[model samples]
Target chain A: MTEIKFWRGFFSILLVISLLFFIFHVWAVILPFAFGIIIAYLVNPLVDNLAAMGLKRSRVVLILYLILLGAGIMLAMTLIPSLIKEANAAVKELPAYTTAIDDLITKANGEIQKFIKPIFKSKSDVIAIPFAAQKFIDSLIPQLPQKILGVAHAGLWIIIIPFVSFFALSHGKSWIDIIFDSTPSEYVENLLGFMAELNATLGGYVRGLIIESLCVGLLTIAGLWAMGIKGAVLLGVITGLVNFVPFMAPLLGGGLALLTAYFQFKSFSVLVGIALLFIGVRLFDDFVLIPFVVGSSVHLHPVIMVFAILAGVEVAGFIGLVFAIPVAVVIKVFLSVALRHRKERLMFRHEHVYS
Target chain B: MNLSFYRLIKKLFNDENHGEEMSFLRGVPIFFGLSSHQLGRIMQAIQKRKYYAGEILFQEGQIGKAVFIIKTGRVELVKNVPEGGEPRLLGNLGPGQIFGEMALLEHRPRTASARVVEDGEIFLLYTATLEALLKNHPAIGVKLMRNIAVMLSALLRRTNQELENQKKS
Candidate 1:
């Protein structure tokens, strides 16, 4: 029995390691399936509502799938082309943007030299500072096109996501049922309960994140457009996408917008306006958007949140950072449930002894 | 494989069990008020499990999150005593009988452990699933909650009478 138990423990640990390895290696290949799961979970309440209204579950799934499919097609037809056009335009205008930035740097350097000329004896020393700065800035410019192309490649995954989601919505329950059926009866109830809790945690967080990102992106576009900033739509998309990363993402997004504004207008007033606009958005995010969409559901300590995000980044880079909070919430749920269950057991034992 | 092969595989795995599940769900009283269509919707969410005789389903003090209804065979609800005493049998439940009913509404610790007396098949309905159902269709939610309330009250009344008898004696 001891030998058998030892083997069981060893195998289970091995299984867990293998599973993690598999997930890490095939993360991109699993995107459709992951997105499918999210789609099914997000749409489940709506399906249940319709089912309660006397609609057949399968029929409702089919109808929802059709509606989503239609929307996706419509988006692809209209939005994709415009987005592509914008991307192309942005690419073609890259040199002009760099030239503008170079002009601003030279102009700023002259102003700096004039202010400091009285202190500096040699004119060459005054020219040296700006020349080194310009060289460093120029090095970064060549990498911009590669980064843009990388984003364009990532956009291709969106096409496969919805197709898989439709099938998932229609038949995800059966897949769950099949899993439950195969599991041991002793663990079945606990597993189901855990899955339900996990669903509640992740469903709310994922859906909320998507909505928050969309709101932030749209608000950013509107803000930037009002301030007459170039690349408002592109910057808005970047802001929305990066909003998934807590604390650091907004800072980076705002910095980019400010830099773009300064380059285009070459004025301190424009940069200040951009910064104030972001501050306003941040205030709205903290006060209004987050509370309404995400809620105060995951009460994780700030210290833990920071560590988890850093650990996530170490493991999986940007994707890891995006999933860090949700994963932490899952871990918190499991730990609390286990601790509570243990406490109940101890209390029962204590009472039994007294009785 | 061809379409027929895929169909055969699917039929063997998924479709064959739904008829059995649907029929069993139709017989449960908590689900009586719901139409066949509504019952069918509920049936999709039902998780079925089979246990051998002497298998433990759940332990006392376990946090209950779902109600279980027996499909076949017997289950005994047992409450443990302190050290040096045998477990006290609370009740023996048979086909169509439900246990852990309060779990559908509240997150409470189980008062008794459930163990199979005979090999059994059971259906579990989770509270989260019910909550979703309630949010979507309040009427159905109300009907189910009312049935649970009625059942609890009857159990309470019986327990009160038993306590009175024990006190008098």
Candidate 2:
């Protein structure tokens, strides 16, 4: 009886998760909502920190939102004209990349055809990437209408997010109180302490990840541009964005770039430099970035982290991967604060023990 | 507005859902992606209570009627294990967690005893009340059940992990 109930419960959960994943990924209207969630996560720590300093969280959030608005406008004012000129120049250079693409594809098609198909099905799988690179260039310049639609879509969310975040952050204090108010009088302090720890761990980890990824992307873009790499802007964006996927970004990004560099320069040294560049970025991220950001967030065993990621992936797909660590941290925090045996923190100054 | 703000803001931030601001339970993994209306319903059905230190929440052999949400302070589970192993202090629970859930879910006699370790608060959701709430507001129930499943799955996973770690050691 128990076994049947258990399996039944498990499958139902799996089903709901899959449904939600489909909803988020497939629904265009849901994108704005997803953006809101991302913005909320990004700004929550800022709101919390501000609130700790005696300002009302909502007003602080409002102030920050205004600053973000100003900064975004300022960035566009400075960056847009230059970006447009370069983008136009890049468009003029598109046919050249297309010719390059066709040449590279033709050169590789023979060697690739020999072994790739039996192992991997499509010829397009290996070839389409470089072609897509050309297509991305073509589409960007030619698809003004699509770009306009995208801007409108993204802009709607951009406008809505601050208002939503403001409300959420400002009134967050009240929200927490309601949660406490719902509590049976006896376990309030215990629950509050547990919640505090959970908040810190989850919030800290997420904020750290955002900062690290942005830092990596910004630095890589600057570095690649300095190195005179073609399409440095695009490559940097791709690398930085993909940087979120721990232990996987370098191989994917580097391998692609290595092929590009190998063909472009047709020499060993450029390839070596490119390879070293990727290795350097990976080393920096793994050794310096992740250690600083993700290390102190949670103390889960590696297996647990892997399981949590898998579970999150199963539940929400790609978006879930981003949220998985924080969720896992929350669960861990729950165990320690809400479920662990009482141990006084040495930091508690003079109070011997609350109990 | 200022009067209301002063009265409310003067109080410690407790309920994240009512009065001052909506509870940020929306950020909680359990309540993710739920609409404000949906999240609000769950918050509304809930009720809070307080308990002093050393109170016995429930005991073995007693039929559990309510699930307790630890708002603050600690609740320890004193369990009787007699396989030549020492009796277990299952845990000391702190804020924002729900316990007595298993008992509430199954009409089982309390398998272990729960006692508050300090002056604490809990939100008691009687099964009968929650059922009615579930009937009237099904989304909240669905979300709540999902959240509980997550908690259970986590507990099960941790137990599995501990067993695996023990084996490895």
Best by lDDT: 1
**lDDT tens digits, residues A136-252, model 2?**
666677778876987787778777776676666666556767776666644453454345445545655667777787777777667667666665666666676666655545765
lDDT of each: 0.76, 0.65
Ten contiguous residues minimizing lDDT sum, candidate 1 chain B = B9-18
Best by DockQ, which number?
A: 1
Per-residue accuracy of model 2 over B1-169 as CA lDDT, tens digit each: 9998987765543333343323434444555666665655545444455677877777654555567777678888877664636657878788766677874366545667788888875665555555645655687777778877888899899999999999999
Name the top TM-score candidate.
1
Interface RMSD of each: 5.6, 16.0
| Candidate 1 lDDT, A159-197, residue by residue in tens | 667667667766776688789778876778778987766
